[model samples]
Target: MIRTVLSLIPAEYARLTPRFLAAVVAQAICQAIAYVLLVPVLKSLFGDDQAAAWAWVAPMLVAVVGVLVLGYLQSLLGLRIGVGMQADLQTRLGDQLNTLPLGWFEGRSAAALSHVVVDDVREVQGLVAYLLAKVIAGVVVPLGVAVGMLFVDWRIAVTMFVAAPVLFAVNSIAGRLYSWSDRRIHDAAVESDTRVVEFAQAQPVLRAFGAVGARNRALDAALTGQRSAIVRMVFTAVPSLFVFTILVQAAFLVLAYVAVERVTHGPLSAAAAVALVAVGSRFIEPLTQAAQLGTTLRSGAAAVDRIAGLLAEPALPESTTPVNPGAATVGFDTVSFGYETGKPVLEDISFTVPAGTTTAIVGPSGSGKSTLLRLVARYHDVTRGRIEVGGADVREQPTVTLLGQLALVSQQVYLFNRSVIENIRVGRPDATDEEVRRAAAAARVDEIAERLPDGWDTVVGEGGASLSGGERQRISIARALLKDAPVVLLDEATSALDPHSEAVVVRGVHQLSRGKTVLVVAHRLATIAHADQILFLDGGRILERGTHDELLTAGGRYADFWNERSRAAGWRLEPAPVG
Candidate 1:
């Protein structure tokens, strides 16, 4: 536990380390002095010099003042350190996450990441601010108090030591048991939270299906599991705590017995015996604190380990000598990738989108069309072979530089909870308002902007929920148009638009993609009918490739798809026969 905390303390806080150490020692010493002064006071009370009692009173008061001043400083410094660590951890995590591949994030739940950064980090901060001070003082105070008692009477010190082994043994076992239970409870709680969040997010669909309870049964089960785990932990831990309490009382009883026996054996005066018994509570108090504090520190260690795991996850390695592509040309040479090993989504795939030409990839659902576009965008590295842009292998180019050369517009567009103008400006942050407005006009975003009360400044609610699908689609196209990258990856970019908006978007796309390398994943055969080349894929391999006219004349899969789609376009609901 101590090792975990020391590793978490950043190097910049090195100076604060000694300051806290001093505070802990000062606080502990003051407490020991306050308790030790009881001996002198008791001696004064029974001795002939009754007026000398006033001398012991002043020093006891001084010790009390010292404890207060040091304790306050310790808390203030500890809180500042805690807050600083929290800020640092958040910043570091964010910076690292930005550099990670999209594939890494795809395998993890958003709820799990949020819980780790926001919830678990806060709990760890609390451990440092509250539990740490108690821990330091708890360890130091007992040792200080024990040394003072030894000077008063070695026999009494020996008696206190008799209970030391028993007290420590019990505390050690309890701490281990509590830490095990804490980790289990922590995991259960996280699972419960993840289930509730996922369930709530899908509530609209669940309600429409009238399967709210049935669909969310897993959430119900997760919560019930958490409750059962917690109840079981309580039943097991309470008995261990009872044993700890019993041992503490036994130590106190043993100290009192030894003190009376010493007086009977003439090893000490009556005054000395009374002082030994007077400060008996202070001797065992620190050990009791340690027993309680151990649990919290151990939990903090677990949180630290979790955060460290995130930081340690390998980021996509960048090229040391990065190269710039000579042109916008893109090539996939025998590329293969999969979410899971041995389950290749695209295998031995090879293709090229020549500069200043359009290449359309058509495939059935789950046929790796979208996955191919994502690879060209370098969201994930090719697992089996190489991908090149401008005759240069993508792996040789720096990720940031590579990203700057391509603009992707997918069917599902994402907009921040910001102004309509700002959402469009995401394509190029440095673009002027006038430039953004020009792009918006080209993509027909201005049509929607005119309907809004605030035009460009209108706040698009979270995920642009306030806007219609066509309006949002236009805005996304406007952003892509503003980017004006050399290579454009259009993944059914106009799928959400109405017929009128779709025509306007097609014109804008033509303008944006003119004289650029274009790789399009087109579901509708009509949209890519005039593509420079078309690759018809099925079962992760390109089955046929040619111009639309050639493919139709070939009377293969493309022709079959075209005939089916054409028939699907003309189908309508038929009137049921009266029976």
Candidate 2:
């Protein structure tokens, strides 16, 4: 288990090795000195002429005071070092997580990562302080006691040496069982976390479907399972304690009998015999504590394994080449991709949008319209072929550099729990208040802002739940306008808006799209009727490419789609007015 934990230590912590080793050495020396001083004092207290040993009192008192002072200093230093180490661990973990690709987050739960970051890191400090300290104390203190016992009688020392191993063997067996139970407890904890997150995220849906009671019961079951596992782990330790107590008491009883016999029948002094029993009893305390701490260390090792597993997940590969795209043209060159292998969502597709023009992508559901936009943004790497932005292959470019050139507004907008101005500032983190207001005005969000109690400073609720759908969409568009990147990608950006809101957002889009490369994916053909060019996609293949008037004249997929959408919007084909 120690080997396993050692493997998990981050390379950045190598600098701390020397200090940690020094701390262990200091604790060992302190424990040994404490036990050595304790033995002579015990003998002196029981001397036949106690009044004559008054000189020993002063030295013993000084030794006790010194031990306490050293112990307190050690604790303070250990706590300081532990906290420093934990801070470093958290920083490293956070950095690693940030560097990882978005796909890594797709398969893992936020709650599980939260546990690793917050709970598991805390356990490391507890393990270092309690387990490492106790183990050092156990070794040095017991050795000191044994040396003291040898002066009294080698027989008692040998008896203790034999009994210690027997007790250890019993504890070792129990520790194995405890380790297994601990694993189950950890698993249950992760399950409980997952359930809580699921319940929280699905609360609205569950309530809408009248499944809240079922969700509550499921969460209850998860908690119950976690509790039961903890109970089993707690009970597993009881047997180890029971065995340790029996073995330790038996060893002391045997040592006491032999010590009395030696004092009465041989040259051993009575004071020495009593001190030998005192030393023997003292050994049991550290030994038992060490056994308990050993279990704690094992449990901590398990938590470390879990945390390390998360950190070990492969992060997004870093790009070495700098991307300096002179033009904002976006293109896909025979790209193929799938969330799962062998079932391509997009296959051998190719397209291009020239700089400073609007290119609309229209497709039926599941035709990979949004996926194509994601490809252009490089959110996920293609399984085959390459996508280029500004005439440079996206894979060769740093993700930051690639994404910096683009602004994205999707069907769903995620707003932070912050003021409207603060949320917009996420796009251009250094934008002035006036610039923010200008962007909001351009997106038509300022219309609503004027009536808000605090205007742009009004706090949006979590996920912007307090805002209307159109308000949120406009806020999202305002963020994009604030970014003012050379390229813009909009995926059904106005889907959630009412007709009036749609017009407001459409006007904003028109103003925002000027002199920028814009790629829009929309199911509503009317939204893209004015687009400079439209590409009609079906089954992940482009079937037609032209303007709305040209595609309508062609009488193909685009024409049929345009007609269907127009009819849905209550437009009647009035025989073209005999033109």
Measured against the true structure, the TM-scores of the candidates, in listed sequence, are: 0.86, 0.80
What stretches of model 2 exceed 4 Å from their correct place? 1-20, 33-66, 129-131, 143-218, 228-273, 291-299, 338-345, 362-368, 528-579
Could you tell me how far off, in angstroms, the CA of residue 132 lies in candidate 2 after the best superposition? 3.2
lDDT of 1 by residue, 1-579 (tens): 656765676677757877976887898899988888888788788777778889999999999999999999988888877888888778788888987887788657776788779877887788777788787777667667777788787877777767777787887787677777877887788889888876765666668877577556778888888998888778767678789888888888888888888889866668867877878888888877776666666667678778888888888878778676787898989989987888989988988888899999997889999989888877788889999987888788888778888889888888888999999999999999999999999888888888899988999986787887678877888998898889998987665567787777778777777888989998665667979999998888999998999999999999998888889868889999999
State the lDDT at 165 in candidate 2: 73
Give per-residue CA lDDT, model 2, range 1-579, as digits (tens). Answer: 555444544566545545655665565555555554554566667776666546655665665666566566656655665676578778878998987766557667667788788888888767654466666677666676666566556887787777777777876787778778888987789889888877876677678877675547778898999999989887887777677777767877887887788899987778867766666667777877776566666778777877777778787777988878879999989999898877888888888889998899997988989989888877678999988999999888888898898999988789998998899889899999999989999999888878789988899877886788888888998999999999999886665668898888888887788899999997666667978889888787888898989998999888888888878878547766665
CA RMSD per model (angstroms): 3.6, 5.7
Candidate 2 clash pair list: none
lDDT of 1 at 539: 87
Per-model CA lDDT versus the true structure = 0.82, 0.78
